[model samples]
Target: MLAHSEWKAAGEQLENQPVAGEQAALNQYAHLVRRVVAHMRSQVGVVADRDDLQQIGMMALLKSIRRYGRSLDEQFESYAFKSIRGAMLDEFRRLDWRSRQSRKEAHDFRDAVRELRRELGREPRDAEICVALKISERQLLNMRYLEQAEVVESFEMLLEQQTHFVDSNEDIEQLEVRQLMTQTLALLPERHRILLQLYYTHELNMKEIALTLGLTESRVCQLHKQSLQLLTEKLKG
Candidate 1:
């Protein structure tokens, strides 16, 4: 076992002799690898392999060691901890990016909502949205149609995007945002609410929703888009 005393000595040596410090840190490989595995398991759940996490974590750990400085305001462990976790998170994002929908269309939809709110001081009707965006109702509907087809994320996934203000730790901001969204969701029509529940809460695909709701897949898709459009405007208010 590498002692805390040894860790301190190696950290101090790193100031004068970086190679020696790096070798010393290697003596404590088990400790660093364990910390990395803990971070991976938290974000990715239990299926993650120890060897894979260890390999990624070691790369991050080495980078941290190389960049760490005695002149910094924080301790070596604190700095290295962030580096290791950030590395793992980047890998996780890369893997998940395949299915990750573009937040752009969703964001643009919200922006249009906000503009209507500012101009009208209330939830603008679809016609009003058409005027505010300077497009005809059919064009606006087309925009929504395209957005709906492009949207692969469910309501729950959207919620996840919103609440990610929570960061690495829980805070009052996360709680407040969640509470507000809960209220906003409740205000939606019963049928619209159900659509959100099936897609986001139940994590169902469009085909599954069509089967369960006894509607055609195209109808379900339209409903999904219409519901989000309504909710986005209402939330803006």
Candidate 2:
């Protein structure tokens, strides 16, 4: 969260004398903040405060406009969507909403799943994981939900960090990072690659992606998690 003074400074900057179509662009695209908030609310579920996310989205919008030189275009919309979503996710990370015990449970659950996968030579089924962990199916699902969020957040943060250094004059290290990312992505299955692109690049939620791909939401979630895990492992290697 931004400090009170920081918010005020941002407001003052945006409210200053307009440059040509800046005001018009602001007015025209003001609804984007709301749209982003609504989409994010659905994605994050009810754990996050709608009003707080909206405020963050608005601030992100102001920053995006300034960053893009107050121009409104198709490209600007994509840029602002990513900016707003990134800001909201950053807040979530800062808040650390999950309890300490919950995080531990999630970690244990993840470990159990990985162990079962290694033993089974494939992704473990829900029943297999529940039995192995001595947990109920409901508990297993809850852990999976939490782990899904953690995985997605971790993957996004990694991408954001890597992409930050990508530029025309990027050094060899940065170029290698980019190449590694591309190669890792290419190694994923076609469906996994498509799912990652839709979720991260196109910013589609799980439900929307399920509908688009003609799969159940649960299946989509599974693929999403698997895809991210593969990317994370390969990239880290």
Candidate 3:
């Protein structure tokens, strides 16, 4: 039975992976792994095998632990959530073709992307994907419907209930956009970055950020607007 503080420490340990504390680090994430597996089994249906998911999760945990940092100026949970979910989603996609009957062909396209990356060490270009999957532009465009439907539906669910935002890994396309946003934040001035972080990540109202920063609320609003404009430009670029 891990106490709240214990769990938090475990998270911290996992985040700051050191050679001396490797095993201890693994122990800390034990609970997170178990919880993810149980949640997947219960919520994601029996489409993917339990053992497979666990293995995928362990790989993800390792990646998270290795890449985890204490100083991205964001919550550790937010970063780990994406990594863990991504690993599981990768596994889910790999098993998708075998798990379903009617959608095998459509699912195979995604599976091909996964397999090719594993084999080729990078994602193939659109032409390469078409060649590998034996898919024409028309077929690829049609497949977008299936893919977009799932992405949009999941995004809607996340917006409706923020809790669901941390559930599964986001698709690769969405993940890129998210990474872009993080990079955009890094390019902004420290004040602008702090303002957005406090307002959005910390869920502080504008007034709260203003009070904490000792600025007028209107000034905070101005900074936020500038930050948004910069972020929007970076995203477009």
Candidate 4:
């Protein structure tokens, strides 16, 4: 919730020089944006920058403030929240579409490994694999990224069983907390969710994930950290 004084100041800024006054409004909006971004990061996963989210949110706030009519009969925060969140969601959707290829590659790699294991009596050596597949190291590495989600426990079996994750009571409770926090995540942009799922569920380290997703490793790491921090805080609560 914004302080009354903060709201009043933003309102005044909106009326004064809507465009030029945005800086002032943004200052106030930053607090609200941070709260929302923090909440979102916890639920889904960090795939977007808090600052980037904040900037988009500010744009949404400006849009709301500019279009808001005295007769709308809606609370300003309610209206602004929807607008700001929508903007961020829109951006997220765009990003999600872009990362689809990496996801497919990951899936295909898993399928290929399963098929190869089934055809061969024993795991093929790297040289035999090269002769059989005729793929370069880069291509193989790309496929390896796919296995991030499906780990082979013994690494010796032709068709390894999927590993089961047994969460501790604490982890289960924390997951519940994260679930509550990320309820709004489904409403977020697709890119944000996809990136988060890949980063968290796939458990791809930053560089590998980045290369797979065509993003900078640093950006991926930062988003990953931010997303984890958000989830931690929400679960703690």
Candidate 5:
């Protein structure tokens, strides 16, 4: 979170020479850049280059301030946070962080689980999947985590698109979509709403959200999926 004084200083600095002000703003918000990069790295695992991600985040932050052209406040912070994260996600998409081998392993893991479920005539247990796949429970958990991360990432991409739509244009169709999304969100369960807010608005990752809500990260992931499903179904209705 940015302090009031920091925001004030950043706003004052940005009123000066453009290049120097941008640098000053970046320096003032360097801590925020680091925090966002750290959170992204945790989500992305070791495959992400921290230095590159931080550079992306810093650039996004600078762009955000210039684009906003408003007083530095809580609204600016929220806007900048989303901008920074969206830029990082764009970089990740460009990099294709998941290796071919990792994708193949994930595909195999899913196929094995599906086969076991069909053969058993029920959803296979974690222990069963581990045995059938010749993987340890921890490995199975990691696979599941990757799957969950994919779902979360997909939802975040949708959100990033929506944010762009809102920012770039406020056409009638977009307004209607925004209204419907608001209504759909309002209909969600209280816990689901909070989880969505924490993740999307507050920009906390699943692990941090798990600690805050006193639930396991896996449960948070499931609830996240469930919440998105409910929103989708409601919007369709």
Candidate 6:
């Protein structure tokens, strides 16, 4: 909840020119964005800069402030929370889609894959798909960028799974999600499973996890990403 003075100041910023209170509000939300981005860095790939995500979240927070009004049913904080998170996720999706091939090209590739799979009676190899599509391997890999959602888990993958297990009308206290989570974690490789346990359950930072695993911090981060990706796949399956 925002303080009374904070709300008043935010309203003034919305009405005035120099964007009063924006800097202060953004400064406060900066911590919020960092937490969100840190959580997301594991879910999404670490390819994006942390600063890039922070900038997108700031933009969304500003937009939320601009659009907010008392006429709406929800409080400003609730609105802003959604705006900030949604903005970051939307930016991630935009980055993913920017490399998309044309609709015709995507469809052609999918058709080629289907045909080759039918002919082979099994999943077509990348080379077979390329030959069937009459495209080089590079082009096939490029097409993969457009089809990331098929191969890699999207950011909302965990959120969707949570919704399925913890609905408004469900039984059992809270062990349901934990049980599911444990089951999924167990499916990962031993190193990955240990890494997740060390970082998450133990609350160790990346640097600490790296030292514990006898790997570099950056390598630990990469392993974190791969582990989550594998866990997401297991959960979805």
Winning model by TM-score: 2
Q: Model 4 over residues 1-237: C-alpha lDDT tens digits?
A: 999999999997766544656566566655656545543442223245666777677767777666765533436655566456557766655555225665576566556656776789666554455456777654554344233212211121211122223464434543553464366345445665666676434434556667888875534543554454443343344
What clash pairs does model 2 have? none
Candidate 2 global CA lDDT score:
0.72
lDDT of each: 0.61, 0.72, 0.57, 0.52, 0.70, 0.61
lDDT of 4 at 58: 70
**lDDT by residue for model 6 (45-163), tens:** 43356777777777777666556644434455545655676677667666663333444665776677778888999976666766777888656655543343333335255644464
Error of 2 at 123 (Å): 6.1
For residues 92-209, what per-residue lDDT tens digits would candidate 5 score against the true structure? 7777767788668768877887899999998777667778889876676567666655655666556544544534552444455556567778988898888877865577876788
lDDT of 1 at 210: 76
Q: Each model's TM-score, in the order given?
A: 0.35, 0.68, 0.35, 0.33, 0.67, 0.42
User: Candidate 6, after superposition: displacement of residue 130 in Å?
Assistant: 27
Which 10 consecutive positions of candidate 4 have the poorest summed lDDT? 152-161
Q: Over the stretch 1-237, how does candidate 2's per-residue lDDT look in tens digits?
A: 999999999998867645666567667777887766645432354246777777777778777788776447678887777678778888888877677876797788768778899999997776777688888865654565676777777887787665644355324544665566677888888989999888766777776888999975656777888899999887777
Mark the 10 consecutive residues where model 3 has the least summed lDDT: 156-165
lDDT of 4 at 91: 69
Clashes of 5: 0
lDDT of 1 at 33: 55
Off by over 4 Å in 1: 1-146, 149-167, 170-178
Give the poorly placed runs of model 2, Cα more than 4 Å off: 1-27, 34-47, 104-143, 164-181
Q: lDDT score of model 6?
A: 0.61
lDDT of 3 by residue, 1-237 (tens): 999999999997776554656455556665556556543331243345667677666667666666664433345555555566556765655565333542564476668768988888975555666788888755654453344324323442333332233445445445654565577679888887887677545646555666899975544544565565565555446
